[model samples]
Target: MDVVIAPDEQIGEIVADDIAALIAARPDAVLGLATGSSPLRIYDAVAERVARKQLSLARARGFMLDEYVGLPPGHPCRYSTVIDEDFVSRVDFAPGAVRGPDGDAADLTAACTDYEESIGEAGGVDLQILGIGTDGHIAFNEPGSSLASRTRVKTLTAQTRADNARFFGGDIDAVPRHCVTQGLGTIMDARRIVLVATGDAKAEAIAHLVEGPVSARWPATVLQHHRRVTVLVDDAAASRLELADYYRHAHAHRHLVS
Candidate 1:
């Protein structure tokens, strides 16, 4: 686990640097992308690189972390549409190169299974970019989600629905109550994970995910078990961490060791 505490705005370029390196090494690298405010900076940074011809995703593939159930096609809030508008359209990724679980499928169970297979057929994700929910959820794996679960449908917890209401005209009812998400087990298959968080709203969750014991109650805590995980946060988000200074010092001198 590598922890980087820095200004929230600067985090995007830092993460983009690693992503640029990965794309340089593997043109077809599978990238796991997350939606929501937390990861927008990263998407913007990567897109800037693509625009500047510093990097390109034309040959790469992408996978979304989750999707709301029953959103109509072309709905602005739909995860697929949002991903295209936010990242894919900005980059040079080939059409059809990115996919998400079929949230509108008649048989969501089968859709989940197929989504799992789709990821496997892609040789698994090389690097997964993530955002942590204020409640400590990751990819909609709310509290009590199984540590070894796979891609599946899950009910949106009250807190999650409320948090997402802002995206739906500030109406909690406008937010779907159900979603299909990659389970902790599925996310664990990624070769590497980069989680980003900011603001005091995420302080508690970030602290739990980094320093607390692994528990189903805090789904993001599962990352503690992952072999390659990088957690990036700003001062407000990292405020609750017990060893913030140590993490900062280590990051500062990382070049010496590298």
Candidate 2:
């Protein structure tokens, strides 16, 4: 994975905006989207572009990475709510262009299969935006999750629930124990993937993911093996990275070449 250490959070947003622009230029772009505080700023940047009439989502499709099971579709914590509050309702994408696993499905396995099939029929994702959990998980694919998994339901670990508690009235117990997520195999199918992180809370995970060996224990580390992965980090998140200078130098070299 190539790393871009932005000077600050706003720079990171600009970097993310550029990535969105690149996706917009594709013939038929399918986007894999993540929701969390880490991605909010980038979403804001993209929304700004749309508001300014600098970009359009007319030809784009979005697929959410995961959704908390058992929540009503209108629940504030639902992925559908996030897409609506963050991007969908604000953008000009056509009806049905934004897709995700059904949180209230009576048969979750069937729901997952349907979600996977729809993504496949659409020709797979062109760009995926990700947010790394402090525990090194991506899209709720918790530690030790199988790399070849398909879309399915999984139990949320205590730490994950606690981490997400703030969104559920700051009560960890209120957070759903289960969520449906696209598998690692599915995520890796995207033509390009962007993982964004900020804050010192993510330092250890970032260090392990960028420098440590690829293992399911830290699912995001698998991106290190993918040729088209790009990791954007703020200074705090990059603090534990030993190869920070190497990344900066490489980015500088690329800038010069262009």
Candidate 3:
């Protein structure tokens, strides 16, 4: 794991530059997408690169990390629609280039299985972007999610629903109570992972994920076992990390040592 501490604005550019390099190396690289506020800055930076003709996602494919169950088709808050509005629409990805779990399938279990199979058939994700919840959840895998779990349906905890209420007009009741998400085990399979966190609100979760034990209580900690993972956090998010100085020095001199 490589921990990078930088200003919030610089983190996005750093992540975007890495993604652009990946696309340059493999035009068909499969990207795992994450929704919510954390990744929006990265998307904005990437979109700017695409607009400037410095990058292209025309042949790239994408997979969303999770989707809310029971949301009507085309719902703005739905992950599928949100991904389109936020990122895909800004790029040149072909029709059907991005896929998400079927939240409304008659048999959600089968949907989860098929979604997993689809990812495998696409050669798996080359890079996955993630955001940690205020409660330490990744995707919809709230606290207590199995570390080796695969794609499956999960009930949204009260805290998760409350946290997501802002997207549903601040009415917690309006938020979906269930979702289909890639499990910790599934996320671990990605060839590389990049998780971004910002602000003081995420400081504790970032600390636990970076320094705490690898337990199901904080699913993001599972990244500790991934061979290729990069955690990009702003100063506020890295505030609680005990080895802050070491991380900063390591990043600053990584080229010389590596």
Q: What are the clashing pairs of model 3?
A: none
Deviation of model 1 at 101, angstroms = 0.7
lDDT of 1 at 82: 93
Candidate 1: residue 75 lDDT (0-100): 96
Model 1: ten consecutive residues of lowest lDDT = 249-258
Per-candidate local distance difference test = 0.96, 0.86, 0.95
What TM-score, over all chains together, does every model reach? 0.98, 0.95, 0.98
For model 3, the local distance difference test gives 0.95
Where model 3 places Cα greater than 4 Å from the true spot, the runs are 256-258
TM-score (C-alpha) between model 2 and the true structure: 0.95
Q: Which candidate number has the best lDDT?
A: 1
Root-mean-square deviation (CA) per prediction: 0.9, 1.6, 1.1
Compared with the true structure, what per-residue lDDT tens digits does model 2 show for residues 1-258?
A: 788888655654665576566766773588888888877777777777778877777778889999999999789989889878887887777888999899799999999999999999999988888999988999989999988888999999999999999988999988999999998888988898888899999999999899998899898888887879888888899999999999888877775434
| Model 1 clashing-pair count | 0
TM-score, candidate 1, is 0.98
Q: What is the lDDT of candidate 1?
A: 0.96
